[model samples]
Every structure is written in structure tokens, then in C-alpha cells.
Target: MHCYFHLVHTHERILDETGIEVSDLEAAHYQALKAIQELKQEGEVDDVDWHGWQLEVVDEAGRVLLSIPLDAAQH
Candidate 1:
């Protein structure tokens, strides 16, 4: 069985509004969500962001397939 991992960065708005600091693991999940959205839109692979957070795509074997840096340009 092949397991896919999606990593995502937490949105600044969400962090500020909630007044919660996301842990490293949670942040990855957030980035994954963003990556999935990008994949859906572009029908391919892409990375976004580069500040304090970023997104990473991985496989079941725990290998990073892609890394996307979250940047302001995306917004």
C-alpha cells in the first residue's frame, strides 16, 4: 500500500485569529491542504510560499516528493 502525505503551512489569518501557534506537524498539514488545492487547479505539481511556512508532499515511505515555499507573491 502506498500512503501519500501532504504538508501545508498554517494561514496567518488563522493563526492570528485563533491566537494559536501551530506546531511543526500541524503546519505541515496546512501546507498539504494548500498543495492539494494547487494540484487540483493546475492539474500538476507546484509549490508556493517561502516565509515562515512552507508545504511539502511526501510518500508513504517518508520521502519528500516536493517542497513548496509559502511566499507573499502567492497572495
Candidate 2:
């Protein structure tokens, strides 16, 4: 299955144009966590601000599978 990971806030959304293929929802969840970790690392390197944002994983049909706060990636 292919899943899209989008970064969304109250007023804006950064869409993932190229979705990833995963075996199942569980794998997709793992990917989301991994993405968060990568984002954290990149933020550390570049001093990016990711406050008030969320990582939203969705299916091709646009059904949200998981939602994680960007702040949760801290520490």
C-alpha cells in the first residue's frame, strides 16, 4: 500500500507528492516515526522551526491513518 505523509498546521499544508509504499498500516506508522526522527535531525542541523505542525499519514483515498505532533519529535 502507498501512503502519503503530509505536514500540516492550522493554515498551511506541505504535501508529500511522492508517497511511499508499505506492507501495511503498521509499517506506515513506523515510516511516519522514522520521518519524524529524520525531521528532528535535519532541524538540529539547520536550525529549522517545526513548532505548531503535525505529521499526518494518509492513504490514497485520503483517509488519515495517523497524526503526530511535530513537537513530539523534540528530545
Q: Pick the candidate with the highest lDDT.
A: 2
Distance from true location, Cα of 6 in model 2, Å: 0.2
Query: What tens digits encode model 1's per-residue C-alpha lDDT throughout 1-75?
Result: 232443356654221111223345456556566555665477443343345554555544556655555553254
Candidate 1 residues lying further than 4 Å off, grouped into runs, are: 1-50, 72-75
lDDT of 1: 0.47
TM-score of 1: 0.35
Q: Model-by-model lDDT, in order?
A: 0.47, 0.87
Residue 12 CA displacement from its true place in model 2, Å: 0.7
Model 2 score (lDDT): 0.87
Candidate 2 lDDT, 1-75, residue by residue in tens: 999999999999999999999999899999999998886676651475668888999999999999988876775
* Count of clashing pairs, candidate 1: 15
